[model samples]
Target: MSFDKFVKNLSEDQKKELLMVLKESTDTDNKVAPKLVPKIEDGSFTTSIQKKQTEGETFGVPVTEMPRFNKFEDDGSDHKDKQNATPDVELTERRRPPFKKITQTCTRCDNTVETHPQFYREFYICDRCLKK
Candidate 1:
């Protein structure tokens, strides 16, 4: 895309035509420096860190300095520092949250345990599938 490189391959008339074409293609936004495209160079083609320009949460290992994350980010809002964490005694006394409870009346074998809501709300997946 450089003028020096492109003009080397052109005749006088063809150069004029090429220059006109280049001028026509030029726009005001060239200040953004067209994305540095890596061809077959830059070593491996499968690197995940050669990230695309983005405006959102770009996940995975960052190409630059990695921001520190505490334990909260790993388990989300579940885990916390020992000082702020729920005591084991309290957890044992509290009723099990619904998300963990197994229900009955499963479309599969009802006589066993109650329905596991994770499997029942969608379709009946028996204990066999649960093992899977």
Candidate 2:
């Protein structure tokens, strides 16, 4: 309706009553309204939620403690030898093959490398391999 027509039809008391009823309905709307909290997904892969942070904390903190090596620290200073220092003399020993000084004889060439006891059992390797 036009302003003049509406004012003409609505008495002052009727207009006041209508305004009050409208305000009341608007107020009641708040009570019936649903909250808009975010639907926090469980953040889980298989229905298992990973704890991002403790209850009292708002954010997660990373563990930083790890192993560290220091060169200067030493408990046994008397027994410790300097890495850059070298000894006055050295003792050397020669290494030998797995088998040596075989009194055994080769079955093919009759070479005296067989007739040994509790050995690798390298019974024969010459004549047969040469034939092959």
- Looking at model 2, the pairs that clash are 104-113, 104-114, 104-115, 105-114
Q: Candidate 1 at residue 9, lDDT? A: 72
- Superposed on all Cα atoms, model 2 deviates from the true structure by an RMSD in Å of 19.9
Q: Compose the digit string of candidate 2's lDDT tens values, residues 24-93.
A: 9999997898877665575744554667774444434443453334447667666456775667887777
RMSD of each: 16.9, 19.9
TM-scores of the candidates in the order shown: 0.18, 0.24
Question: How far out, in Å, is residue 89 in model 1?
Answer: 70
lDDT of each: 0.63, 0.64
